[model samples]
Target chain A: DAGVTQSPTHLIKTRGQQVTLRCSPKSGHDTVCWYQQALGQGPQFIFQYYEEEERQRGNFPDRFSGHQFPNYSSELNVNALLLGDSALYLCASSLDLIQETQYFGPGTRLLVL
Target chain B: AQTVTQSQPEMSVQEAETVTLSCTYDTSENNYYLFWYKQPPSRQMILVIRQEAYKQQNATENRFSVNFQKAAKSFSLKISDSQLGDTAMYFCAFITFVGSQGNLIFGKGTKLSVKP
Candidate 1:
């Protein structure tokens, strides 16, 4: 019964570069959502993926995109990263859309310098 | 769009005492859900408790409980017999009944410090 897992607990990227964060959904879960948490702030929704398609997205720029694989794993890609992109990226897995409780991962901390 | 607000940016409580974190939300819809998530220093987001809009009894989990006021659109979390482990950043989240397609709106969060 493994919970949601994310890769690269910490990462460093340079401005104008690109970074990819990976997430594996919890067992028995199908939906995957991504969030960004800045220092001392709560997480803000990035987007959600279901059935290999992005279902809903937050007020993020086009530079932020995501993909969900057949195995329910997800990858968040940020292109042309800026220093403001530096934050903790959290991955959550839920069973369905309607008010389901989501289980979250430890999150990947990205530092852009 | 639904919005959640946590006015208190920080709070402190003595160990073995009780503390309450405040939260309020605005939504036009009749049905929705609310949640309290705790993010400790490790950065793992843990669900503390949740409340469905239709439930009037409120929701409780162990030492954590919620005071849900539908009319006031207020949802506050109360932690009793607080321990050092309970120190964390607490966030209030809201979601409508429209299903998973709706995104969760989170408050700015309240940082709780438990003094031993």
Candidate 2:
């Protein structure tokens, strides 16, 4: 079975630019969540998508948004990025909706230069 | 809001030895879940172990075990017979059981170095 997969292993962008990261949920999984991990720090939850709608969100600003397709794949879009936006964007997939164990992907590294 | 705390910023363990990473969380909810995730140099958040709040028995997976003290709101991860592969940043995470939304709150993380 294939685990969660993310695209654009690495990216470079400038301040005020926009970037979108993609993720394919693990087989048999339906829920997708996004997280941001800065260097030497733990990941901070961005948001979660279920049934093609955002069910939960963290303290992130409106610049951060996400979409979940019918196939359970997800995309995280960040607009008007700031220097702090440069971090590793991780995608996690869970089988259930009630805070079950989440399987994570390799993550896409974003660098705002 | 739930908050997880990992006091140890860095820890070192000799190969084949055991190391314990401490974590404490603050939550008002009676029911919740806790997790320990390991991130190696690859930066992938790998689930190491999980413990349900209602379960009195501690959760263990192979060489990884957790000491969950519900009264004290503490959850510590114990890695036995550590190996070079165990060297990584370990994060403690928490989530409440209030809703279908599974939002995880994570600690700063503890960097574990296994010396060969």
The pairs that clash in candidate 2 are none
Model 1 lDDT tens row, B9-110: 999999999999999999998888899999999999999998999999989999999999999999999999999999999999988756446777899999
- Per-residue lDDT tens digits of candidate 2, residues B1-116? 57888999999999999999999999999888899999999887899999999999999999999999999999999999999999999999987866665578899999999999
**Docking class of predicted structure 2:** high
Instruction: List the per-model TM-score of the A chain.
Output: 0.98, 0.98
DockQ of each: 0.77, 0.81
Candidate 1 residue-wise lDDT, A32-102, digit = tens: 99999998788899999999999999989999999999999999999999999999999999986553689
Output the TM-score of candidate 1: 0.97
Off by over 4 Å in 1: none
Interface root-mean-square deviation of model 1 in angstroms is: 1.5
A1-113 per-residue lDDT for model 2 (tens digits): 99999999999999999999999999999999999998878889999999999998988999999999999999999999999999999999988687478899999999998
